[model samples]
Target: MFLPFSRYLAFALLSIHETVCTELGTSPFNLRPFSINLSSGVRTMLNKIKTTELPHFPEYPGVGSSFGIDLNTLKSLRKEWLTSFDWGKEQDSMNQFNHFEATIEDLTIHFIHEKSSDPDAIPLLLLHGWPGSFLEFLPVIDQLVQTATTSLGKSISFDVIVPSLPGFVFSSPPPANWTVHDTARVFNTLMTDVLGYSTFAVHGTDFGVGPGYALYDEFNKTTRAAHFVFLPFYPLKPDALQALNITLSPLEKFEEQEFIQWDSSGSGYFLEQSTKPNTLGLALYDTPVGQLAWIGEKFISWSDPHAGTGGSVLDSNEILRSVSLYYLTRSFISSLYIYAQNPHGFATEYTKAHTNAPMLFSAFKYNVAFWPPALAEKVGNLVLYRNHESGGHFPGLENPSALIEDLREIGTYWTT
Candidate 1:
């Protein structure tokens, strides 16, 4: 369990020289301070997984519904999409950026590595979460690149890297018992060893929030800082009014109130996934509509109904496409496994596997239902904290510009 610090630095440097800089397009100002090769033991451990296709989870009847929206809405959305939305056109638009895959812990991890036109542009590791994909950040990435190039200058572009979580879309499944922490380590290897980033800022949204924090914990040892759309720890403050600042507008508040009242509420998915993920995942993997509905519910429920309510946010179509990645990868099960394996209240036997390094945390007002910012600060040595009037669960997709700005600020002040 004791990952040698020496090995860790070596893996990072190996990434910096052989993979990160050359691949990413610039060398850090100084690497003489760090080693750049993996220790033999670390190399042996890293080589353990033999890459292979995941077992073909046979599709089952009613399984497709697992991804599609509720039957009634699914019908309407399907009509709209079939008659209007264009995948071929969309594919070309996405191809404007770079995409690559590298073997990490036996899985072929997929990522979009868009180096900014800016040579001095900061390297950023952007992660997407469950029921989502790398595509979630595409809109934000586009804006960041444009802003950096036009406003900041050509050398101000982001050397951005967005990766699909293992077992989700493009990326291969976890061969055996991979957890979020393990995934974080794999990403560490990817960013440092495969991509050659000696230091980089990490950002994530949704479930990506957890691994993002984990990666920051890992990367902060040699890199800069970490930012997340969702922070898990919740702290109760004295002011009831302060905590009552819900993201819902008057109409939306009525909708959510009705939702909480009528629907069986409060993250039933979390309960199921945390307890019996495989059983539910079996059904979700087969029922695309079911999967879509499950994910769609979160999209509609999580974001601001009117985009302007908070920082500019993702519209409905963008959310759906992000969900589609999970379906295409048939990763509903593997992704849910992170929940089942969560060690939050579990014994040290499982918990001691990873480090809980101090993090620079931000809890968007909308994301507080799960991990309120005041509560999050209690868990770690919180170095940075902020509360936004807007921004819901999926911040990257919701308010990319604001998220990017916050990230740039964190990089400027904390990366040193």
Candidate 2:
């Protein structure tokens, strides 16, 4: 929470430099500091789930029973969430960081901005995916903002910015005509106009990857660098993979098999959200437990089994916090619209073109799509690519320390 005097001095110096450089261009946009204040009605609904009567059916037999979140697991989680969880404390903890809202092209965008005391800290933008809020990055946020010296004696720090993507929780919903490209333009304004950062780095996962890629592709001059855990685009064909001139290791082969299995059995959510989000969202909107079952399934299944032995790789509180935000803000339905808006998917030839800006990829061992290092090169000016042994799709939550360390390495490519 506190930086050393030397580190504080470094931050102060950088802050002065940033002020001088950014002050030259007056921002056309306005950014107002905001706070989280859950309404009493929403809080009451979240707390009443324990007493609400849930539908019951006879347990199905065999492996098929695990096809969805087991009813008992939901019941137990509901009990704990209502009885043991404390939303007030959690809200206060989140409020500890700086939060702001900016109206970008008529839509209100909510974000957390934690400026490092080290004036030289690189400005970094973090994007979160579906079923995830800014909460995903909370575990590693402090480490990123604090000044630290790496093993090689490199001083590393960042001016961290984590935003709720359009229509996710606090952020306003995207217009019907809006796509990820539109979101990209707004976020670009957010960085250069609202925050007055001339250039910044980006990291994204899941749905966030779409906007992240859009920013890198469409605004390479200002988006100086990027890192991604998910690229929402189609994987390269076998022939194309062969063209990369790299052989797959046994571990890589195993990852391929896992991906195949996942695509076959685990992608139903995609179809529903992309095609008929409203139909399902309306059905689940009134029932908190229903939303839990729908979103909680992915949190449990998509995470690495080895990451946590309990119900999910993420703790109960983490999962509930995400769901609670959606419920309280009434953004669950709008969040699903991102899938519908980008029906063609994000793998365009334009996105595939390489940029001069440095790009990095961190492929988690248990991620749904296993993008080999060879295939990743075709996408960008690939500078750093690393594979982890034990994280899944939600690395920010499943493995924060690893995510933080990888993000810190991005500073190596930062230019003045």
What TM-score against the true fold does each predicted structure earn? 0.69, 0.89
| Position 268, candidate 1: lDDT | 68
Task: State model 1's lDDT.
Answer: 0.57
| Number of colliding residue pairs in each model | 38, 4
lDDT of 2 at 368: 80
Per-residue lDDT of 26-109 in model 1, one digit per residue for the tens?
Answer: 543222221112123222221221121222442443644344234555555444444554444555555555555676656777
Question: lDDT per residue, candidate 2, 310-348, as tens digits?
Answer: 323477777777788888888989988899998876564
The regions of model 2 sitting more than 4 angstroms off are: 1-28, 55-58, 149-152, 236-246, 308-313, 348-351
Candidate 2 Cα deviation (angstroms), residue 162: 0.6
Q: Which one wins on TM-score?
A: 2
